[model samples]
Each structure stands twice: as C-alpha cells, then as structure tokens.
Target chain A: GESVGLHLPTLSVQEGDNSIINCAYSNSASDYFIWYKQESGKGPQFIIDIRSNMDKRQGQRVTVLLNKTVKHLSLQIAATQPGDSAVYFCAESGPSGYSTLTFGKGTMLLVSP
Target chain B: EAGVAQSPRYKIIEKRQSVAFWCNPISGHATLYWYQQILGQGPKLLIQFQNNGVVDDSQLPKDRFSAERLKGVDSTLKIQPAKLEDSAVYLCASSLAWTQFYNEQFFGPGTRLTVL
Candidate 1:
C-alpha cells in the first residue's frame, strides 16, 4: 500500500496567526483527499476536501491546496486559536470512492496563546 | 442532525479477554466504516459496509476481529482473546453512497480500549 506522510510531526502556531501543515502522498492514482482534525479523546472531524480535478478548495476558515504534479497536499487554518489545537490527518482516496480513505501518519497542531 | 454515537467510551481488560464496541451512525447514512488508531499513528481502516453488505475488510485481521452491521443502521466490532497490542481507539464513521463525491464522513467519539 502506498503511504502518506506529513512534513512535520508537530507544529506550533501563535493565536490569531495562520497555520500551514503539509502532507505528501506516494499514490498518484489517488483522486481525492481530505483533512481531518482529531481532538483529544474524540474522533476525527472533517475539515476540508479537494478532488484531483481542482487545485484548491476552501471551507469556513480552512483551505486545502493540492499539487497533483508533486503529489502534495496542505491544510491552512486562518486565525489559529487554542481551540484548534489537535492532531490533523490527511487522507487520500482513489476514484473508488469515499469508502477507501488511506490516512497519513498525522500532524499535531498546537495553537498557543 | 445527531452525530454518530458510540458506546463504552473507555474499556479496560486483561490480555486474552474479549471485548465489543457498538456504534450507531447518523440517520439515513448508507456507508459505514471502522478504523483502529494506535498511539502516535493515524487511524487505519478495518472494515467498511455499504448498506447491509460489506464493501471492504481487506485490512481486518479476521482471525481475531469480527464485525457486523445486522440491519445496516448500527454496527458492532468484536475482538476475541485480545492482545496487548489491540489497545487503541476504535472509531466509527458514516458517509453517503459512493456515487456522490460530496459525501463527507461523520465520525463517532470512539471507544478507547486499554489492555492491562
């Protein structure tokens, strides 16, 4: 199975600042990708997603940028808050649909006041 | 709409003991998924169900793990003779049909099992 890994295991950002987390996937066949945020003792929550057909997508205060040419994906959070601190994961899926989401190792985002 | 619900928020048992976890997806969801998350690692898929039928279980260790979604609305996962390594957070998620790319999964709080 192909692997998806984050450029950093942990990231710290100051409150009110923008934060960027990067992920790299090895499978070019992947056509869809999503970002999830997992709070302590809770399941992952959907953040944003992008399809291969597009290079970027935006959600409320969150943005996902995909560079298919490099097989890289990133999540950007605007106005980081302590409440946003959590482990973030980037998952990839092929045209097979949403049932087969392959996850990355994950990055812990710590927003400090 | 109510989010996915899971039971036994936390569990502790000795090695070789058996345990089960339950999950109820959001109303009208047709796709269900089970994943195992070890400490310091991301969640890994264990099984997936589409309606009342299984769509994938390739990563599941059938020798020790078994899951069922009897009526396709709720599901249960069982681990028999659990090992120390089996201690992790088991998460349940639900999505819409595969034909829709707008399908985004909603996850439950998860069951954290500790093997002592």
Candidate 2:
C-alpha cells in the first residue's frame, strides 16, 4: 500500500518570515515528488518538483528537498507573503513512469500580513 | 494554451439523486484523470484514461460511479443514486504522453458538488 502524509496540518507564519512544511511517505519505490500550492476555491498549482536522483530542487521562491533514507519530503518558502497563504500538498509518483500519484494530506500555510 | 476545462462549476443535489460532470482535457494531452477531494484531504484518484481507453479505475467506486472518454478527447463522470459521502470536489487533470522524465499534470478548477 502506498500512502503519503504530512507531519503538520497547519503552519502559521508571520509576514516576510520563512516557512517549512514536512511530509513522509510509506513507499520506497516512489521516484518523483512534487509540491503544489492551492488557494481558496482554486485548484492546486504546481510549485516545484524533485526527483529521487536529486536531493534538492529550487524554484522562484520555493524549494523542495527529498530524503530517501527517511522517506521524507519537505517544502520551504522564503520571505513568505500574504499571497502565499494556502494549502500546500506533496505528491509522489513511483519508480514506474506514468503511474498514479499519491498525494499527502495538505498542510495549510497561513501567512499573516 | 488553455488548461483543463470542467463543468458545471458547482452543483447541489439531494442524496439518492443522480449527477454527472463533464471535463475537457488540454489539447494534445494523452492522459486525463479525475480526482475526488474531500474537505481537509488530498485529492484521490477516481479514474484515469489514456486517450479513449481506461488505464486505471482501481480507486473508483464502480458500484455507483461510471466514467467514459469517447474519441480519446472529452470525458464525463457520473454517479447514480448519490450518497452524502459522495460529496466532494471533482478535479480534472491532464498530461502529455510519456515524455521520458518529465510529465507535468496540469489541473483544472474543479466542480464542487454538495449532496444534501
């Protein structure tokens, strides 16, 4: 059975501060991991992705780190803004390409302005 | 480039009533997927189609749910005799065909369903 879960259900941060969200997965066969940001009433938007071959990946203001040994994943947002307030989800696809992605229970990131 | 399209934006129905949702994937995408997102939870896969054929429907509740993709393009998902537990947001997403290492799934604004 493949399942992904987040360590925290809600993360609150002051404006302009940094935020870190963590996730853990049960499947070792997962090869690809992605982070998505979802605003109220909107779909989850792609933020960044990291592959098992790589330990870390960076985007405009976000970063995703993969720890295969612990089967853990993390997303970091620097200088978090009010606009960044939303639910963030981590998803994973397996060693096989074109496989169904398993998504973790999202973590709501509330950035206070 | 347009993203995936789904309708109606919202629906309210009573339990035991039937409902259906329509989805149009991004042009040229070979894979289409439907997901159910309950409040406070991540999206769960309902069904997947690689063109007009079914690739996976393992998580789908086949007893009351049904879906189809004709001509490998547009798709529809239907639930007969809906239950209160069937209430959730239905999301549609698509991705380009097998392209080696990168296959990004573009999602559409989902349809919010409420069964009272």
Candidate 3:
C-alpha cells in the first residue's frame, strides 16, 4: 500500500543549532502535508503544514519544504531548543476533499542543552 | 478553548476481556476522529465521524472493535475480546468541519490501553 516514511529514525542536536527532519511519501496524489510534534505522554500537536500547490511554507521558527517531483518533504527548525525534544511526524492527506490523514513512522528529535 | 478530552488515561486488561474508552471532542466541532498509535509508530486512523454519522471506518476491526458517536458530541470506542495487539494509545481529535481543504485538528491527551 502507498505510505509515508522518514529518512532518519532519530536526530540529535545541541541547543541553538538548526535541525532538519526529512520524510518521503509514496503517494503522489496526496495534496496536503502536515508536521506534528508529540511530547512524552501527550498527543501529537500540529506544527506546520504545506499544500501541494506550494513548495514551501513557514510558521514561527519552523519551515516545511515540499518536493512533489520526488515526493519528498522536509521540516526545518531554526535555533533548536530543549523544549523541542519530541517525536516529529509528517502526515499526508488527500487527492479527495476529506481530511483523512496518513501519518509516517515518525522521527524522534533530541535537543540537548 | 478546551481541546479534545478523553477519559481513563490508562487501562490494563487481560486478553479476551472487554474495555471501553470515552472521548469528548471540542465544542462545536462537527468532525471527530479516532486513531490508534502503537509504540514507536505514528497514529493510524481507526474511524472518522462527521456529526453523528460515520464517514470512514475501513481500518477498524469490525469483528472485535466498535465505536459510536452519539448526539454528535461524545464518543465511545469499545473492544470486545481484546487481543494483545490492542495495546496502544487511543487518541481522539476534532476539527471544526470536514472540508475539501485542510482543517486543523485538535487532539486530546489520549488513553493508553494495555492488553496483557
């Protein structure tokens, strides 16, 4: 079945440094993508999202880059902080109008101070 | 505003037993979703409800798993004769409406279930 996946299972970085998490999706028909942050013992929180029509979208200190030609997506966080330590997941939804999301395995991001 | 709410943060039940989890979505939200998230993996949609009607439930184990969203507000997910593989976190989320375009969903803390 078509699915979403990540390049790295875990990413470690020091505080104040930049971090980039990469995801690869197999469904070309998907039109919308979202990045979520899940802390320990909590549900996933929406971070940022990008539509297929756009190549890039930015929110707060996070940026989402979408490459439809390769079916690849990436999330960039500027000035990483300790609070950013969590599992980050990239979810895809779409060719239809409904908002059903298909999530990836997720990449754990560790930010050490 | 309050986010989605779920009950019984944790539950431990033996296999073959029955367990039910409750959820209360954000006020005025017309769409509700239930997802199962196993350890180290991302949340998988189990069912989706538009108002009180089911919109999607293809992934749900209909033989053993059942759900209901009554009054278009609170919902309950029940598992009969639970299996060990049912051990996972159940998350409830709600969106203002179901649209062709993207609508942000607000998630609850989640209910952790352990089927031993």
Which has the greatest lDDT? Answer: 3
Query: What is the model-wide C-alpha lDDT for candidate 2?
Result: 0.88
lDDT of 2 by residue, B60-102 (tens): 9999999999889999999998999998889999989754465
TM for candidate 1 is: 0.93
State TM-scores per candidate.
0.93, 0.94, 0.96
TM-score of 3: 0.96
Q: List the residue pairs that clash in candidate 1.
A: none
Runs in model 2 lying further than 4 Å from the true structure: A1-8, B99-102
What iRMS does model 1 reach?
5.3
Q: Model 3: how far is B18 from its true place, Å? A: 0.4
Candidate 1 reaches a DockQ of: 0.44
Per-residue lDDT for A73-104 in model 1, tens only?
Answer: 99999999999988899999886564388888
Give Cα distance to truth, residue B112, candidate 3, Å. 0.6
Worst 10 residues of 1 chain B by lDDT: B96-105
Which is the winner by TM-score between candidate 1 and candidate 2?
Answer: 2
Ranking by DockQ: 3, 1, 2
> Which of 1 and 3 is ahead in DockQ?
3
Model 3 lDDT per residue over A1-113, tens place:
11112343889999999999999987899989999999888889999999899999999999999999999999999999999988899999998558589998799898999
Model 3 regions more than 4 Å off:
A1-8
